[model samples]
Target: MAFSNPFQTYQKQAVSTSRPEELTYMLYQGLVKYIRIAKNSLENKNFEESNTFILRSQDILSELMITLKTGYPVTDSLLSMYDYMKARLIQANINKDQQILEEVETYAVELSETWYNAMKEMKIKN
Candidate 1:
């Protein structure tokens, strides 16, 4: 019998049960996490590992972009921000620049904070 990793199983369950807003919050969390690890790897002069992490974070940003609903003014602004972030990530990966990763991390933090607070407000109002 193949033993499944408990953490992986738990993560799949958590995702399956989460609401849309919760999933968005989770994506932001993952993005920030990947960016931080990439930054650390870059700082340590581990270029290959940094590239892998940055690409993983970029994929999350792409997912966020793909799922954005149309007809809302906020969506346009968010699209722009996501595009900028992805571009910055590409540049950071190519250059192996820790500073660029830090800048991207700041944006990720802002996005996650704003998203989380908005969700909390929505919950209270509902």
Candidate 2:
């Protein structure tokens, strides 16, 4: 059996490194952090806190994408998926929808895992 560092293995890899580290790094970090918080809170039946984390995560993603002139490889379907998930997150927050929140939390974890895995393989870091 082998043990590996998941954090190092699953970080997001940006296509270009010309930008400042803060611009490239913190958004991704925030995404990763809030997703975990949301997931954990939902699993614990803490709906309020989970919703908060989801909103925070959405804000981070919105902020990061706002200033990007060069787009990365998050394709149209994925972009639509993000928008849909983000909307569901907001709806969950407004309606106190636990089931939807759990679903979104699961989605976030999977997406983050995929993003991190690719980043790890590409050897990109802050």
Candidate 3:
């Protein structure tokens, strides 16, 4: 996104293009990566690695909200989501449950979809 206006970069996408979908996919990939790391770490009883991935996932979520320019409603929801995700990460670390990591991944995917849809609505086509 090397543009003077970041929003403009998103707007330039072709109507038939897959960039928007790709973005969603990319977010999912990130979620999968982090969650997988989390699962492996939790399975090995590596609390630190699990914690790290959780924090990374949280950071990605924060960046997603900022990128989407989400309004109050979305912002409020994101706040709750972020809190829940962080809590889950901590719980996964403590309980060493791979399932908990998968649950968090589900939330991440949902959030990505929501963010991409919201941004699509706001985009001003070129």
Candidate 4:
């Protein structure tokens, strides 16, 4: 018999039960986290770890971009922002630039906060 980590199990259940808005919030949080880790790794001179984290952040951005629904006015703007962030991540990864990572982190943080607020407003309405 194999044992699973309790935290991992809890996380899986949480994600499985979350609404789409919650999932988007989670992704934004993840993007910020990966960017922060990449920045720290770069600061520590860990090129490989930094590269890996930056790539993870870019993947999250790609996921966000692909999941956007069509016919919404905001969708196009959000897609553009995601594309810009991914480009910055690529530049950060290539140059190992902490400043570029910080810029992306700023955007990720803002998006995460905005999403959280929107969720709150939605819950209030419902």
Candidate 5:
């Protein structure tokens, strides 16, 4: 039998059991990680590697946009931000621009921190 990595198994179980809020926070964390890695790849002149990571980041942003509930006022604003980030990611991938990737990373960091704080507050309340 082929062996599966234990960490991958743990991650799959964690995601399957995570609440919606936790999932959102996890997505933000993932987006930030991809952008940072892409930035490093760009700096090293690894254009293909950078493009791959940028695409991953863009995919996560798209998933977040689709999963977001539409009724709330904040949803519109968040959608706009996601659109802007995706556009920047495309531009970064096309031009291999570290600056554009950094801009996207800044947004990702802000979003992740905000979501993490909200998650903590919800846990405290419950």
Candidate 6:
């Protein structure tokens, strides 16, 4: 018999049960985490691990772009930001540059915080 990790199971449940706004916040959080890991790994001279994490962060950006609604005026700006971040991640991965990773991490953190605040305000209004 195989054993499943409780934390992994819990994370799966959390994601499965989360509302769309919550999922967006989670994605932003994930992007920040992966970028941070990639930066740390790069600083430690772990190129392979850094590359893997960078790719993961890029995937999150792609997912965000795909799921974004087009009717909103802000959609274009958000898409542009996601594209820029993904490009920065590619540059960081290719050059093994921690500075570039830091730049993306800053954007990710800001976006995550903004999303969290919006969710909070939504809850209060409803």
TM-score of each: 0.98, 0.56, 0.56, 0.97, 0.96, 0.97
Largest lDDT belongs to which candidate? 1
Q: What is the lDDT of residue 86 in candidate 4?
A: 98
lDDT of each: 0.96, 0.68, 0.71, 0.95, 0.93, 0.94
The TM-score of predicted model 1 comes to: 0.98
- If the candidates were sorted by their lDDT against the true structure, best first, what order would they fall in? 1, 4, 6, 5, 3, 2
| lDDT, candidate 3, at 53 | 84
**Which lDDT value does model 2 have at 89?**
75
- Between which residue pairs do clashes occur in model 3? none
Q: Model 4 Cα displacement at 54 (Å)?
A: 0.5
- TM-score attained by model 4: 0.97
Give the runs in model 2 whose Cα sits over 4 Å from its true position.
1-29, 35-51, 64-74, 124-126
User: Model 3: per-residue lDDT, tens digit, 1-126?
Assistant: 654776666655533366655665565568768888877877788888788887787676665555554567866776677677878877876677788888988877676677667667767553
Better model by TM-score: candidate 2 vs candidate 6: 6
lDDT of 4: 0.95
lDDT of 6 at 101: 91
Question: What is the per-residue lDDT of model 6 for residues 30-121, given as tens digits with 9 covering 90 to 100?
Answer: 99999999999999999999999999999999999999997787998999999999998999888888889999999999999999999999
Task: Please count the clashing residue pairs in each candidate, in the order shown.
Answer: 0, 1, 0, 0, 0, 0
Tens-digit lDDT track for model 4 on 1-126? 999999999999999999999999999999999999999999999999999999999999999998999678899899989999999999999888899999999999999999999999999999
Candidate number with the higher lDDT (3 or 6): 6
lDDT measured at residue 123 in model 6 versus the true structure, 0 to 100:
93
Superposed Cα deviation of residue 58, candidate 3 (Å): 4.1
**Model 4 misplaced stretches (Cα beyond 4 Å):** none
How much lDDT does candidate 2 score? 0.68
